[model samples]
Target: YEKSSTILTSNKSYGEWGEIFKDHVIAAALLDRILHHCTTINIKGESYRLKERKKQGIKTGLIRHNSTEILEN
Candidate 1:
């Protein structure tokens, strides 16, 4: 990864990594290297899956929208 470009996606924030990964030290070390030459751009909105479900008349009942939208660069 250090010699080439890589792309990763995570819905959780930095502070939540300790709990997300179940180890603060490992999370910290991992983030340290990843963020060294990283560019972060956050996009917040309703999930397209839900949107399509709604279009198909599937009842989601007001659940929180968690979308994984791809970024093109």
Candidate 2:
């Protein structure tokens, strides 16, 4: 485990992982192992996709229908 590197990226915070795995116990155990030998980096900013859309003069509006959302130009 020493001298090894791993990268993991997630938009969800640690507290929200339980919902993802559908079991708090499993999430906790997995996090314990991963975090035991991990370095965390939190990034905060506008999404790169949105920034690129804005730069390209693409409309960033959404049209909703029922539970689905369609992006509009």
Candidate 3:
């Protein structure tokens, strides 16, 4: 038998995932499964979208987030 690999990618950190899913319990379960026997790699850099905008002479500004509103119903 051969083993298969699964790949999951996210722009947010593990702690911030509850906001993305709107449920901390679900996020925990999902993460638990994916992280079991998994290897992790983190890549950091300026976003490609922002990089291209800068190249085209378009000004870009830092994006701000309000944590309180993220999981609002």
The residue-by-residue lDDT of candidate 2 on 1-72, one tens digit each, is 767778788978889999999999999999888888556766565565677887898987843233322222
- lDDT tens digits, residue span 14-60, model 1: 78899988999999998888788677666566666688898988888
Q: Pick the candidate with the highest TM-score.
A: 2
Name the runs in model 3 displaced over 4 angstroms.
Answer: 62-73
TM-score of each: 0.67, 0.70, 0.67
Cα deviation of 67 in candidate 1 (Å)? 12
Cα lDDT computed for each candidate against the true fold: 0.75, 0.73, 0.71
Instruction: Please name the candidate that would achieve the greatest lDDT relative to the true structure.
Output: 1
Q: What global local distance difference test value does model 1 have?
A: 0.75
lDDT of 3 by residue, 1-73 (tens): 1299676777788899989999999999988777776677765655667878888988777554423212211
**Model 2 lDDT vs. the true structure?**
0.73
